[model samples]
Target: MEINLNKHISGQFNVELEQIRNDVLKMGGLVEQQLTNALNAVNNFDHDLAKQVLENDIHVNKMEVKIDEACTRIIAKRQPAASDLRLVLAIIKTITDLERIGDEAERIARVALESFNKAQQEFLVSMDNMGRKATTMLHDVLDAFARMDVDAAFEVHQSDKALDKEYEGITRQLMTYMMEDPRSIPKVMDVLWSVRSLERIGDRCQNISEYIIYFVKGKDVRHTSEDDIKENVL
Candidate 1:
Protein backbone atom coordinates (compact mmCIF):
# COMPACT_ATOMS: atom_id res chain seq x y z
CA MET A 1 0.00 0.00 0.00
CA GLU A 2 3.03 2.26 0.03
CA ILE A 3 3.05 4.66 -2.90
CA ASN A 4 6.17 6.63 -3.81
CA LEU A 5 5.13 10.28 -3.95
CA ASN A 6 8.70 11.61 -3.70
CA LYS A 7 9.18 12.33 -7.42
CA HIS A 8 8.14 15.99 -7.27
CA ILE A 9 10.72 18.78 -7.32
CA SER A 10 9.03 20.59 -4.44
CA GLY A 11 9.19 18.52 -1.27
CA GLN A 12 6.31 20.49 0.22
CA PHE A 13 4.16 19.70 -2.79
CA ASN A 14 5.01 16.04 -2.46
CA VAL A 15 4.04 16.15 1.20
CA GLU A 16 0.73 17.81 0.35
CA LEU A 17 -0.07 15.15 -2.23
CA GLU A 18 0.88 12.38 0.16
CA GLN A 19 -1.16 13.90 2.98
CA ILE A 20 -4.34 13.99 0.92
CA ARG A 21 -3.75 10.43 -0.26
CA ASN A 22 -3.36 9.32 3.35
CA ASP A 23 -6.53 11.14 4.34
CA VAL A 24 -8.48 9.39 1.60
CA LEU A 25 -7.25 6.05 2.90
CA LYS A 26 -8.32 7.02 6.40
CA MET A 27 -11.77 7.90 5.14
CA GLY A 28 -11.90 4.64 3.22
CA GLY A 29 -10.94 2.69 6.34
CA LEU A 30 -13.76 4.26 8.31
CA VAL A 31 -16.27 3.57 5.56
CA GLU A 32 -15.17 -0.05 5.42
CA GLN A 33 -15.70 -0.42 9.17
CA GLN A 34 -19.08 1.23 8.92
CA LEU A 35 -20.23 -1.24 6.27
CA THR A 36 -18.97 -4.16 8.32
CA ASN A 37 -20.66 -2.94 11.48
CA ALA A 38 -23.90 -2.27 9.65
CA LEU A 39 -23.94 -5.78 8.18
CA ASN A 40 -23.26 -7.33 11.57
CA ALA A 41 -25.95 -5.19 13.15
CA VAL A 42 -28.55 -6.36 10.66
CA ASN A 43 -27.57 -10.01 10.89
CA ASN A 44 -27.51 -9.98 14.68
CA PHE A 45 -30.41 -7.57 15.11
CA ASP A 46 -28.19 -5.39 17.30
CA HIS A 47 -29.92 -2.04 17.73
CA ASP A 48 -27.03 -0.51 19.69
CA LEU A 49 -24.48 -1.49 17.04
CA ALA A 50 -26.69 -0.02 14.34
CA LYS A 51 -27.06 3.23 16.30
CA GLN A 52 -23.29 3.46 16.69
CA VAL A 53 -22.84 3.15 12.94
CA LEU A 54 -25.27 6.06 12.41
CA GLU A 55 -23.34 8.19 14.89
CA ASN A 56 -19.98 7.41 13.27
CA ASP A 57 -21.21 8.36 9.79
CA ILE A 58 -20.65 12.04 10.60
CA HIS A 59 -16.94 11.31 10.96
CA VAL A 60 -16.88 9.81 7.46
CA ASN A 61 -18.66 12.88 6.11
CA LYS A 62 -16.18 15.15 7.89
CA MET A 63 -13.21 13.27 6.41
CA GLU A 64 -14.63 13.70 2.94
CA VAL A 65 -14.97 17.45 3.50
CA LYS A 66 -11.46 17.73 4.94
CA ILE A 67 -9.84 15.80 2.09
CA ASP A 68 -11.89 17.69 -0.50
CA GLU A 69 -10.67 20.99 0.93
CA ALA A 70 -7.10 19.72 0.74
CA CYS A 71 -7.58 18.82 -2.93
CA THR A 72 -9.03 22.27 -3.69
CA ARG A 73 -6.07 23.89 -1.97
CA ILE A 74 -3.67 21.79 -4.04
CA ILE A 75 -5.42 22.70 -7.27
CA ALA A 76 -5.42 26.40 -6.36
CA LYS A 77 -1.83 26.65 -5.16
CA ARG A 78 0.17 23.76 -6.64
CA GLN A 79 -1.58 23.44 -9.99
CA PRO A 80 -0.45 19.84 -10.33
CA ALA A 81 -0.23 18.49 -13.87
CA ALA A 82 -0.16 15.06 -15.51
CA SER A 83 -0.11 12.18 -13.06
CA ASP A 84 -0.14 14.48 -10.05
CA LEU A 85 -3.29 16.20 -11.27
CA ARG A 86 -4.87 12.83 -12.03
CA LEU A 87 -4.08 11.68 -8.51
CA VAL A 88 -5.85 14.66 -6.99
CA LEU A 89 -8.86 14.27 -9.26
CA ALA A 90 -9.10 10.59 -8.50
CA ILE A 91 -8.96 11.26 -4.76
CA ILE A 92 -11.80 13.74 -5.13
CA LYS A 93 -13.98 11.20 -6.92
CA THR A 94 -12.98 8.34 -4.62
CA ILE A 95 -13.98 10.21 -1.49
CA THR A 96 -17.33 11.06 -3.03
CA ASP A 97 -18.01 7.35 -3.67
CA LEU A 98 -16.77 6.47 -0.18
CA GLU A 99 -19.10 9.01 1.41
CA ARG A 100 -22.05 7.65 -0.51
CA ILE A 101 -21.07 4.16 0.54
CA GLY A 102 -21.17 5.39 4.13
CA ASP A 103 -24.65 6.71 3.54
CA GLU A 104 -25.72 3.30 2.23
CA ALA A 105 -24.28 1.68 5.33
CA GLU A 106 -26.30 4.11 7.44
CA ARG A 107 -29.40 3.14 5.53
CA ILE A 108 -28.73 -0.53 6.13
CA ALA A 109 -28.16 0.10 9.84
CA ARG A 110 -31.59 1.70 10.07
CA VAL A 111 -33.11 -1.60 9.00
CA ALA A 112 -31.79 -3.14 12.19
CA LEU A 113 -34.22 -0.98 14.19
CA GLU A 114 -37.23 -2.49 12.42
CA SER A 115 -39.09 -5.60 13.53
CA PHE A 116 -39.46 -8.75 11.46
CA ASN A 117 -41.47 -11.86 12.20
CA LYS A 118 -39.78 -15.29 12.39
CA ALA A 119 -40.86 -16.13 8.84
CA GLN A 120 -39.72 -12.71 7.57
CA GLN A 121 -36.36 -13.21 9.26
CA GLU A 122 -35.39 -15.99 6.85
CA PHE A 123 -35.00 -13.44 4.08
CA LEU A 124 -32.51 -11.54 6.20
CA VAL A 125 -30.15 -14.50 5.93
CA SER A 126 -29.97 -13.88 2.21
CA MET A 127 -29.56 -10.16 2.77
CA ASP A 128 -26.74 -10.81 5.21
CA ASN A 129 -24.93 -12.92 2.65
CA MET A 130 -25.25 -10.14 0.11
CA GLY A 131 -24.07 -7.57 2.64
CA ARG A 132 -20.95 -9.62 3.39
CA LYS A 133 -20.09 -9.84 -0.30
CA ALA A 134 -20.59 -6.11 -0.77
CA THR A 135 -18.40 -5.43 2.26
CA THR A 136 -15.62 -7.58 0.81
CA MET A 137 -15.77 -5.74 -2.47
CA LEU A 138 -15.46 -2.42 -0.65
CA HIS A 139 -12.44 -3.67 1.28
CA ASP A 140 -10.72 -4.98 -1.86
CA VAL A 141 -11.27 -1.77 -3.78
CA LEU A 142 -9.82 0.28 -0.92
CA ASP A 143 -6.82 -2.02 -0.91
CA ALA A 144 -6.39 -1.51 -4.64
CA PHE A 145 -6.63 2.27 -4.17
CA ALA A 146 -4.02 2.20 -1.41
CA ARG A 147 -1.61 0.26 -3.62
CA MET A 148 -2.73 1.86 -6.87
CA ASP A 149 -3.04 -1.66 -8.21
CA VAL A 150 -4.78 -1.54 -11.55
CA ASP A 151 -5.04 -5.33 -11.75
CA ALA A 152 -6.66 -5.50 -8.33
CA ALA A 153 -9.03 -2.76 -9.33
CA PHE A 154 -9.93 -4.59 -12.49
CA GLU A 155 -10.68 -7.71 -10.51
CA VAL A 156 -12.96 -5.74 -8.22
CA HIS A 157 -14.68 -4.15 -11.19
CA GLN A 158 -15.39 -7.58 -12.61
CA SER A 159 -16.69 -8.85 -9.27
CA ASP A 160 -19.64 -6.45 -9.35
CA LYS A 161 -21.40 -8.44 -12.06
CA ALA A 162 -21.61 -11.44 -9.78
CA LEU A 163 -22.96 -9.23 -6.99
CA ASP A 164 -25.61 -7.93 -9.34
CA LYS A 165 -26.59 -11.48 -10.20
CA GLU A 166 -26.88 -12.29 -6.52
CA TYR A 167 -29.03 -9.21 -5.99
CA GLU A 168 -31.42 -10.33 -8.70
CA GLY A 169 -31.73 -13.78 -7.20
CA ILE A 170 -32.43 -12.40 -3.75
CA THR A 171 -35.00 -9.96 -5.10
CA ARG A 172 -36.84 -12.77 -6.83
CA GLN A 173 -36.87 -14.80 -3.66
CA LEU A 174 -38.29 -11.87 -1.69
CA MET A 175 -40.95 -11.23 -4.31
CA THR A 176 -42.04 -14.83 -4.13
CA TYR A 177 -42.17 -14.65 -0.34
CA MET A 178 -44.48 -11.65 -0.47
CA MET A 179 -46.70 -13.33 -3.07
CA GLU A 180 -47.08 -16.39 -0.84
CA ASP A 181 -47.69 -14.46 2.37
CA PRO A 182 -49.35 -11.13 1.67
CA ARG A 183 -49.36 -10.29 5.37
CA SER A 184 -45.54 -10.22 5.46
CA ILE A 185 -45.27 -7.67 2.66
CA PRO A 186 -44.54 -4.71 4.90
CA LYS A 187 -41.68 -6.36 6.81
CA VAL A 188 -40.40 -7.95 3.61
CA MET A 189 -40.27 -4.55 1.92
CA ASP A 190 -37.94 -3.29 4.61
CA VAL A 191 -35.63 -6.24 3.98
CA LEU A 192 -35.96 -5.59 0.28
CA TRP A 193 -34.80 -2.00 0.68
CA SER A 194 -31.93 -3.07 2.87
CA VAL A 195 -30.75 -5.53 0.23
CA ARG A 196 -31.05 -2.78 -2.33
CA SER A 197 -28.69 -0.69 -0.21
CA LEU A 198 -26.23 -3.57 -0.23
CA GLU A 199 -26.48 -3.72 -4.02
CA ARG A 200 -25.79 0.02 -4.28
CA ILE A 201 -22.75 -0.38 -2.06
CA GLY A 202 -21.36 -2.87 -4.56
CA ASP A 203 -21.92 -0.32 -7.31
CA ARG A 204 -20.03 2.28 -5.28
CA CYS A 205 -17.12 -0.11 -4.78
CA GLN A 206 -16.99 -0.73 -8.52
CA ASN A 207 -16.93 3.01 -9.10
CA ILE A 208 -14.00 3.38 -6.72
CA SER A 209 -12.14 0.61 -8.55
CA GLU A 210 -12.69 2.47 -11.81
CA TYR A 211 -11.21 5.56 -10.20
CA ILE A 212 -8.14 3.54 -9.29
CA ILE A 213 -7.70 2.54 -12.94
CA TYR A 214 -8.36 6.11 -14.10
CA PHE A 215 -5.63 7.45 -11.82
CA VAL A 216 -3.01 4.93 -12.89
CA LYS A 217 -3.86 4.74 -16.60
CA GLY A 218 -5.66 8.06 -17.16
CA LYS A 219 -8.46 6.10 -18.83
CA ASP A 220 -12.18 6.75 -18.19
CA VAL A 221 -13.58 3.24 -17.95
CA ARG A 222 -17.03 4.18 -16.72
CA HIS A 223 -20.01 2.92 -18.75
CA THR A 224 -17.63 0.64 -20.63
CA SER A 225 -17.96 -3.11 -21.06
CA GLU A 226 -15.77 -5.67 -19.30
CA ASP A 227 -13.92 -6.45 -22.54
CA ASP A 228 -13.25 -2.76 -23.06
CA ILE A 229 -12.09 -2.26 -19.49
CA LYS A 230 -9.85 -5.30 -19.78
CA GLU A 231 -8.27 -3.85 -22.89
CA ASN A 232 -7.75 -0.53 -21.16
CA VAL A 233 -6.21 -2.13 -18.09
CA LEU A 234 -4.10 -4.66 -19.90
Candidate 2:
Protein backbone atom coordinates (compact mmCIF):
# COMPACT_ATOMS: atom_id res chain seq x y z
CA MET A 1 0.00 0.00 0.00
CA GLU A 2 2.81 2.45 0.86
CA ILE A 3 4.57 1.65 -2.41
CA ASN A 4 1.44 2.44 -4.43
CA LEU A 5 1.02 5.74 -2.57
CA ASN A 6 4.62 6.69 -3.28
CA LYS A 7 4.15 5.96 -6.97
CA HIS A 8 1.03 8.13 -7.08
CA ILE A 9 2.79 11.02 -5.40
CA SER A 10 5.68 10.77 -7.87
CA GLY A 11 3.24 10.89 -10.76
CA GLN A 12 1.61 14.01 -9.39
CA PHE A 13 4.97 15.71 -9.05
CA ASN A 14 5.77 14.84 -12.67
CA VAL A 15 2.51 16.37 -13.78
CA GLU A 16 3.32 19.60 -11.93
CA LEU A 17 6.68 19.82 -13.63
CA GLU A 18 5.04 19.38 -17.01
CA GLN A 19 2.58 22.13 -16.20
CA ILE A 20 5.41 24.55 -15.41
CA ARG A 21 7.16 23.68 -18.66
CA ASN A 22 3.99 24.24 -20.65
CA ASP A 23 3.40 27.62 -19.06
CA VAL A 24 6.90 28.78 -19.95
CA LEU A 25 6.46 27.66 -23.55
CA LYS A 26 3.18 29.48 -23.81
CA MET A 27 4.80 32.67 -22.58
CA GLY A 28 7.56 32.29 -25.17
CA GLY A 29 5.02 31.81 -27.93
CA LEU A 30 3.16 34.95 -26.98
CA VAL A 31 6.37 37.01 -27.04
CA GLU A 32 7.34 35.54 -30.41
CA GLN A 33 3.98 36.41 -31.95
CA GLN A 34 4.23 39.93 -30.58
CA LEU A 35 7.60 40.37 -32.26
CA THR A 36 6.29 39.04 -35.59
CA ASN A 37 3.26 41.31 -35.47
CA ALA A 38 5.39 44.32 -34.59
CA LEU A 39 7.62 43.70 -37.58
CA ASN A 40 4.62 43.30 -39.88
CA ALA A 41 3.19 46.54 -38.62
CA VAL A 42 6.43 48.33 -39.39
CA ASN A 43 6.71 46.78 -42.84
CA ASN A 44 3.13 47.61 -43.80
CA PHE A 45 3.07 51.01 -42.03
CA ASP A 46 -0.12 49.90 -40.34
CA HIS A 47 -0.85 52.23 -37.48
CA ASP A 48 -3.66 50.06 -36.19
CA LEU A 49 -1.42 47.02 -36.07
CA ALA A 50 1.22 48.96 -34.20
CA LYS A 51 -1.40 50.06 -31.72
CA GLN A 52 -2.47 46.46 -31.27
CA VAL A 53 1.09 45.40 -30.52
CA LEU A 54 1.40 48.11 -27.93
CA GLU A 55 -1.87 47.08 -26.33
CA ASN A 56 -0.87 43.44 -26.14
CA ASP A 57 2.27 44.31 -24.20
CA ILE A 58 0.07 44.70 -21.12
CA HIS A 59 -0.92 41.07 -21.48
CA VAL A 60 2.69 39.95 -21.64
CA ASN A 61 3.53 41.90 -18.51
CA LYS A 62 0.60 40.31 -16.69
CA MET A 63 1.70 36.86 -17.71
CA GLU A 64 5.18 37.52 -16.38
CA VAL A 65 3.78 38.54 -13.03
CA LYS A 66 1.51 35.53 -12.81
CA ILE A 67 4.27 33.13 -13.80
CA ASP A 68 6.61 34.58 -11.19
CA GLU A 69 3.95 34.22 -8.52
CA ALA A 70 3.20 30.68 -9.52
CA CYS A 71 6.87 29.76 -9.49
CA THR A 72 7.23 31.20 -6.01
CA ARG A 73 4.27 29.19 -4.77
CA ILE A 74 5.62 25.99 -6.25
CA ILE A 75 9.03 26.53 -4.66
CA ALA A 76 7.57 27.32 -1.27
CA LYS A 77 5.05 24.47 -1.20
CA ARG A 78 6.83 21.73 -3.13
CA GLN A 79 10.34 22.42 -1.76
CA PRO A 80 11.94 21.19 -4.97
CA ALA A 81 15.70 20.58 -4.91
CA ALA A 82 18.66 20.03 -7.24
CA SER A 83 17.62 19.63 -10.88
CA ASP A 84 14.03 20.46 -10.12
CA LEU A 85 15.17 23.71 -8.53
CA ARG A 86 17.28 24.49 -11.58
CA LEU A 87 14.33 23.95 -13.89
CA VAL A 88 12.07 26.22 -11.89
CA LEU A 89 14.73 28.90 -11.64
CA ALA A 90 15.31 28.76 -15.39
CA ILE A 91 11.61 29.25 -16.04
CA ILE A 92 11.56 32.31 -13.83
CA LYS A 93 14.58 33.79 -15.54
CA THR A 94 13.42 32.98 -19.06
CA ILE A 95 10.03 34.56 -18.54
CA THR A 96 11.66 37.76 -17.33
CA ASP A 97 13.77 37.88 -20.47
CA LEU A 98 10.76 37.10 -22.65
CA GLU A 99 8.78 39.92 -21.09
CA ARG A 100 11.59 42.35 -21.77
CA ILE A 101 11.76 41.15 -25.36
CA GLY A 102 8.08 41.90 -25.69
CA ASP A 103 8.68 45.41 -24.39
CA GLU A 104 11.46 45.96 -26.91
CA ALA A 105 9.22 44.82 -29.77
CA GLU A 106 6.46 47.13 -28.63
CA ARG A 107 8.89 50.02 -28.40
CA ILE A 108 10.05 49.36 -31.95
CA ALA A 109 6.46 49.33 -33.15
CA ARG A 110 5.77 52.60 -31.42
CA VAL A 111 8.80 54.14 -33.10
CA ALA A 112 7.61 52.74 -36.42
CA LEU A 113 4.29 54.49 -36.03
CA GLU A 114 5.88 57.80 -35.14
CA SER A 115 8.16 57.77 -38.19
CA PHE A 116 5.80 56.07 -40.62
CA ASN A 117 5.19 59.27 -42.53
CA LYS A 118 8.90 59.98 -42.92
CA ALA A 119 10.32 56.50 -43.39
CA GLN A 120 11.58 55.39 -46.79
CA GLN A 121 11.04 51.97 -48.31
CA GLU A 122 14.74 51.07 -48.31
CA PHE A 123 15.21 51.75 -44.59
CA LEU A 124 11.97 49.97 -43.74
CA VAL A 125 13.12 46.84 -45.56
CA SER A 126 16.39 46.76 -43.63
CA MET A 127 14.61 47.21 -40.32
CA ASP A 128 12.14 44.45 -41.18
CA ASN A 129 15.00 42.06 -41.94
CA MET A 130 16.64 42.84 -38.62
CA GLY A 131 13.38 42.27 -36.79
CA ARG A 132 12.88 38.92 -38.47
CA LYS A 133 16.37 37.77 -37.59
CA ALA A 134 16.02 38.79 -33.95
CA THR A 135 12.65 37.09 -33.61
CA THR A 136 14.03 33.91 -35.12
CA MET A 137 16.87 33.93 -32.62
CA LEU A 138 14.40 34.32 -29.76
CA HIS A 139 12.29 31.43 -30.99
CA ASP A 140 15.29 29.13 -31.34
CA VAL A 141 16.58 29.97 -27.85
CA LEU A 142 13.20 29.17 -26.34
CA ASP A 143 13.11 25.90 -28.23
CA ALA A 144 16.54 25.02 -26.87
CA PHE A 145 15.34 25.71 -23.36
CA ALA A 146 12.22 23.60 -23.79
CA ARG A 147 14.25 20.61 -24.92
CA MET A 148 17.39 21.29 -22.85
CA ASP A 149 19.34 21.17 -26.12
CA VAL A 150 22.80 22.66 -25.58
CA ASP A 151 23.75 22.51 -29.26
CA ALA A 152 20.65 24.44 -30.27
CA ALA A 153 21.33 27.02 -27.59
CA PHE A 154 24.90 27.44 -28.84
CA GLU A 155 23.52 28.05 -32.32
CA VAL A 156 21.66 31.06 -30.96
CA HIS A 157 24.88 32.54 -29.59
CA GLN A 158 26.64 32.09 -32.94
CA SER A 159 23.71 33.68 -34.73
CA ASP A 160 24.07 36.72 -32.52
CA LYS A 161 27.44 37.48 -34.15
CA ALA A 162 25.62 37.78 -37.45
CA LEU A 163 23.08 40.08 -35.86
CA ASP A 164 25.87 42.29 -34.60
CA LYS A 165 27.35 42.51 -38.09
CA GLU A 166 24.00 43.51 -39.53
CA TYR A 167 23.47 46.16 -36.90
CA GLU A 168 26.87 47.66 -37.64
CA GLY A 169 26.07 47.77 -41.33
CA ILE A 170 22.78 49.51 -40.68
CA THR A 171 24.45 52.03 -38.41
CA ARG A 172 26.99 52.89 -41.10
CA GLN A 173 24.30 53.30 -43.71
CA LEU A 174 22.22 55.56 -41.48
CA MET A 175 25.26 57.69 -40.61
CA THR A 176 26.05 58.12 -44.29
CA TYR A 177 22.49 59.10 -45.04
CA MET A 178 22.46 61.69 -42.27
CA MET A 179 25.78 63.15 -43.37
CA GLU A 180 24.91 63.30 -47.07
CA ASP A 181 21.57 65.04 -46.62
CA PRO A 182 20.97 67.54 -43.87
CA ARG A 183 17.21 67.45 -44.54
CA SER A 184 17.13 63.69 -43.84
CA ILE A 185 18.88 63.97 -40.47
CA PRO A 186 15.88 63.87 -38.14
CA LYS A 187 14.15 60.95 -39.83
CA VAL A 188 17.45 59.11 -40.10
CA MET A 189 17.91 59.46 -36.37
CA ASP A 190 14.57 57.79 -35.78
CA VAL A 191 15.60 54.90 -38.00
CA LEU A 192 18.88 54.68 -36.10
CA TRP A 193 17.01 54.38 -32.81
CA SER A 194 14.79 51.61 -34.19
CA VAL A 195 17.81 49.69 -35.41
CA ARG A 196 19.51 50.14 -32.04
CA SER A 197 16.51 48.66 -30.31
CA LEU A 198 16.64 45.66 -32.63
CA GLU A 199 20.33 45.17 -31.90
CA ARG A 200 19.62 45.15 -28.17
CA ILE A 201 16.94 42.54 -28.81
CA GLY A 202 19.57 40.37 -30.43
CA ASP A 203 21.81 40.80 -27.38
CA ARG A 204 18.96 39.67 -25.14
CA CYS A 205 18.52 36.59 -27.30
CA GLN A 206 22.17 35.76 -26.76
CA ASN A 207 21.69 36.16 -23.03
CA ILE A 208 18.74 33.78 -23.15
CA SER A 209 20.90 31.22 -24.94
CA GLU A 210 23.51 31.50 -22.21
CA TYR A 211 20.82 30.88 -19.62
CA ILE A 212 19.71 27.77 -21.50
CA ILE A 213 23.28 26.47 -21.46
CA TYR A 214 23.48 27.05 -17.73
CA PHE A 215 20.20 25.33 -17.15
CA VAL A 216 21.31 22.26 -19.08
CA LYS A 217 24.98 21.97 -18.14
CA GLY A 218 25.18 23.86 -14.85
CA LYS A 219 27.84 26.08 -16.35
CA ASP A 220 27.97 29.77 -17.23
CA VAL A 221 28.79 30.22 -20.92
CA ARG A 222 28.58 33.99 -21.12
CA HIS A 223 31.56 35.71 -22.84
CA THR A 224 32.93 32.27 -23.64
CA SER A 225 34.23 31.16 -27.04
CA GLU A 226 32.50 28.49 -29.10
CA ASP A 227 35.47 26.16 -28.64
CA ASP A 228 35.38 26.73 -24.90
CA ILE A 229 31.64 26.21 -24.83
CA LYS A 230 32.17 22.76 -26.29
CA GLU A 231 35.29 21.88 -24.33
CA ASN A 232 34.15 23.21 -20.96
CA VAL A 233 30.37 23.01 -21.08
CA LEU A 234 30.13 19.63 -22.75
Q: Could you give candidate 1's per-residue lDDT for residues 143-164 as a string of tens digits?
A: 9999999999999999998899
> Global lDDT of each model?
0.90, 0.81
What is candidate 2's CA lDDT for residue 114? 65
Off by over 4 Å in 2: 1-10, 115-119
Q: What is candidate 1's TM-score against the reference?
A: 0.97
Give the alpha carbon lDDT tens digit for every residue of 50-159 in model 2. 99999999999998998899889879988887667777787888888889889888987886586544445566677877887898898899888777777998899889
- Residue 140 displacement (Å), model 2: 1.3
Clashing pairs in 1: none
Model 1 misplacement above 4 A: none
Query: Which candidate tops lDDT?
Result: 1
